[model samples]
Each structure stands twice: as structure tokens, then as C-alpha cells.
Target: MTADGGPDGAEPETNTGVLLFLPYRALENRVFAALAEAGFDDFTPAQARVLQRIGPHGTRLTDLAEQAQVTKQTAGFLVDQLEKAGYVRRVPDPTDRRARLVCGAEKAWAAKEVADGVVAQVEKEWAEHLGKRRMRQLREALTSLREITDPWA
Candidate 1:
């Protein structure tokens, strides 16, 4: 078990948790945990990726695929999975019937609220620990680190 009570009482004996932990990784795990608690068990990571790319106004399937960095067929499969889960729908574009817009379902929006609450709680805890100025500094530092670590990003 680690110091965060991840399992048994045994704790990791160093500062490795903060040093090695990636914030994005932690957020992803938290989001999935919140989604499970919210009774959204049907959606997969791939499906979620597609839905996220769709955004609030909806997006073309091709754009979603590009944003997801996946092949068009793979994005279509992900969209299909999301549609099957009742979390998203594909509708004909009013401007262009030939293209479809992937939109989030009402239930998906509700589940998103739950996920947002979880993230807010996590953020609150982190802010309390780091304080406003320190948190801002950390964000700036991380931004710089990201530029250095992933120039293409």
C-alpha cells in the first residue's frame, strides 16, 4: 500500500509520489472513477475520446477523427460505441446533409457534470495544498516543461 491509502497500510518511503506522478494521468483516473460512480459504465476510453473531440456544438466525424489522432474508421467505431451506450448521437448537419455532427446526449451531459464535480474537488484540494500563487507558479512551470518535453505539443 502507498501513502495515499491506495491499498494496505504499507507506505512508499520517499517523495516519489509528487516527483514521478503525472497530473494528467491522475486526472484521467479520477474522471473514470467518477464516471463509474455516476453509473456511466458503458463508455470506453476510445468512445470518450471521440465525444470529447465532438465538443458542445458538435463536430464533423472527420474533425473528431483528426482531433483524436485516430483513423477515420477507428473514430467511427468509437462513435458507434458511444451511440450504443446512449451517450452520443450522430445527426445530419443542417448546413450539409452529407456530413454528420456527433453530439453529446442529455445523459452524457449529466454524467459530465459528475465528472466535473470530481475534478473540481480534486482541484480544490490541490489549490488548498499549494495556495494560489504556488499553484499558478506550478501551472506556469508545467507549461514550460511541456514545451521542453513535447515541442510538437
Candidate 2:
């Protein structure tokens, strides 16, 4: 209805930002559902967001808070919950004795395996629907976009 052809000049479906988020939301839903079914049902999305940022060698609490875009206290609370659930453990950082690193436990890894399978299944379905070429292009575009949007990426 606008001169540019957007409804009230607001881009909805055709908005690049909205388009980019749709697939991610869908994938996240699938992963969480799969995780629940696999008996790793104690995790909240907030806790998982922090858990996902833990590096292989473990990561500092401050870093996880920064990467997950949460306050330090909030991150600490989530990490404490994760620790109680047996999904993560805190250990002294090798590089810094005064600091601690959060590391994923075997339980977390098992849940991640389930989540990974779900993601792979979703990606395959997307490739089938979008065609492999479009899927690849979409991935590449997102990765390129991360260079700007994601500080850690």
C-alpha cells in the first residue's frame, strides 16, 4: 500500500532480517523438542544459550555471559543450574588460576548429539525443499553476515 509496495511501508515477509531469523527459529524449536524427547529435558533455552558458548577447552563465565548477551549474574545462575543438572562442571582455568572455566559434561555431550541430529535432519529437509544450491547459498550468506553481526564469529 506504500509507494515502495510494502504494506503500510513496513516490510514483513520480504524483510531480510525477518527472513534470516525464520530458519533459525525453526531449527531452534526442533532442537529443543528433540532434546526434550531424549530425556535431557531440564534445560531452559537461556541455560542452553550459555551452554552452547562453552568452548571445547571450556570458557570463562564472563565470556559465556558476553557471548550469550546476558548479565554476569544471570549467566552465573544459569551455569549453576546446569551444574546441578549434571550438564556442566566448573574447573579452574589452566591459563589463569584465579578464574574458572565452564566445561560440558558427558550428559551435555549426549544432549548435544541429539540436538545435532535434529539440526542435520532439518538442514537436509531444507536442502530438499530449497534445492541444494539455494541451501548452500543461504548458508554462505549467513556465514558472511556473521562477520558483521557476530563478534565471536
Candidate 3:
């Protein structure tokens, strides 16, 4: 180990957590850039975190909060902002009259389209770099890891 924690003096980021976070951060940045380019730049990362968990039909505030690992109040606040921005709407939960579900608006779906395209493109680039076999293996490994890493999974 040298002064930089490696013989080559590379920054010390060999840990599993950092390695996993790097590509995720890159994908996130690319998605946000594409979203901004597509005229959907009013949201923040924290808000997007909560928004990503909303189901196809809808999701309860409590559920969103739990899935996003945030407090109900925080989720509510983020949802409020999303509502103001026309990205989401609250509706009766049908099964429970007293409960409401957060449903994605058309604007939110539009943003999702842009994000999905970027994600697909990024995956293609990653696959090109890593080769199909290695990339498929990588994805399989990550998906297997998600069983332990993701609470909802």
C-alpha cells in the first residue's frame, strides 16, 4: 500500500458499497440529465426517490414512505411538491375510503419514458463494454444480491 492506499496511488474505493454506488450514481446522473433535456427538471433527488416507488395503479403514502425508507411526513411533503408540479395526483384508495393513493400523472409518465430510454441506453453501453456474457452475469449477480439488499425484494 502506498500513500494513496494502493501501489498505483489510486483513490481507495475498492469496497463493495462504493463499487455498487458508482454505476448507480452514473445512471442517476444520466437519467436526470435526460429528464432535464426533456423539460422535466423541477424535481429533486429526494423527491424522485419516493416517486420511483409509486406502483402502476397507485401506492399509499405509508407504503411509499416505507419503500423509500423515509418518514410518512417526508413522503407526504415530497408528494405535495410532485402534486404541485403536476407529476402526481392523490386519489381514494378504493379499498380503503379513508386512505389515498399516489398515482403518476401524464407528466410523470413522460419523464419516466425519458428516464427509461436513458437507462436502456446506459445498459447497452455497459453491455458493449463488458460484453454480453459478462454483462448478463453482472446483472444476475446484482439481482441475486438484491434479495438481501432490497427490503421489498
Candidate 4:
């Protein structure tokens, strides 16, 4: 190890993937804070993640699990909690009788509205720091990367 604690003189920087998660974690924290302020304090972070992946129309449990990168059992457990809290409901899938679709309930829609506002506020703050053009470019870059990184997206 050198003086900088690396093999050579150079210091190591944070991994880009971990760095990317920092902002996401911050946004998640902000969203939780906003949700708590709105009196929606029953939801947990894990449940919120599953909830966020649910399509506007509805989504299968397997898809939710896949998108959230969690196991089917874990996703089902989270969905059960959300259902009990009135945030989501399981409905019969029109296409497949054996499958059930998780649909956002009225409370979920209301919470989504709040979460969306918080996301917009955070994005505005990030844009101010990164400059509007750079922020747009950043979003475009990330979106493009999703094609390779996110199998469900």
C-alpha cells in the first residue's frame, strides 16, 4: 500500500454503483418523511419499494417480485401488509385465473400523489445543483442504462 492506502500513490474513489444508490436512498428518506407528515405512517420502506413497482393498472406478484429484486415470498408478504393497510388489493387477473394482480387502492393513489410531489421537489433541487441541462442529460443517460441494468424496466 502507498501513502494514499492504494497499491500506488492514487486514492480510491467510491464505486459508481454505490454512489448512484446514495441519491436514491436520500430520495427514499425524503419520501418516507413526507409520507409520515401526511399521516401515512403505517408503511415500511420495504413495503414502499414493492408498492412503487406496482403498475398504475395492476401488476402480477411475480412481476413485482422480479422488479423489486425480492423473492416471491417476500413480495407476497409485503403485498399482504399493504393490502391490510388499504394501500393495495389483490384482484383476479383477467388474463389468467390462476394469477392475481396487485392493484393500488384509493389510499395508494393518494400516497402516490404525495410521493410524486416529493420526487419532483427533489429532482428540482438536484437540477439546481447539477444545472438544468446536465440534469436532463443525466436522466437520459440513466434511462438508457436501464435497458442493460434493469431486466424488469
- TM-score of each prediction: 0.75, 0.90, 0.91, 0.91
In candidate 2, stretches whose alpha carbon ends up further than 4 angstroms from where it belongs are: 1-13
Task: Give the range where candidate 4 is weakest over 10 consecutive residues by summed lDDT.
Answer: 1-10
Segments of candidate 1 deviating more than 4 angstroms: 1-21, 140-153
Give lDDT tens digits, candidate 4, residues 1-153: 212445555567666777798899999899999999999999999999999989989999999999898999999999999999999999999999999999999999999999999999999999999999999999999999999988666
The residue-by-residue lDDT of candidate 1 on 39-113, one tens digit each, is 888888878777766689888898888878889999998888888888888889999978999898898898888
Give all candidates' CA lDDT scores: 0.82, 0.89, 0.92, 0.92
TM-score for predicted model 1 compared with the true structure: 0.75
Order candidates by lDDT, high to low. Answer: 4, 3, 2, 1
Candidate 3 residues lying further than 4 Å off, grouped into runs, are 1-13
Error of 3 at 53 (Å): 1.0
- What TM-score does prediction 3 earn? 0.91
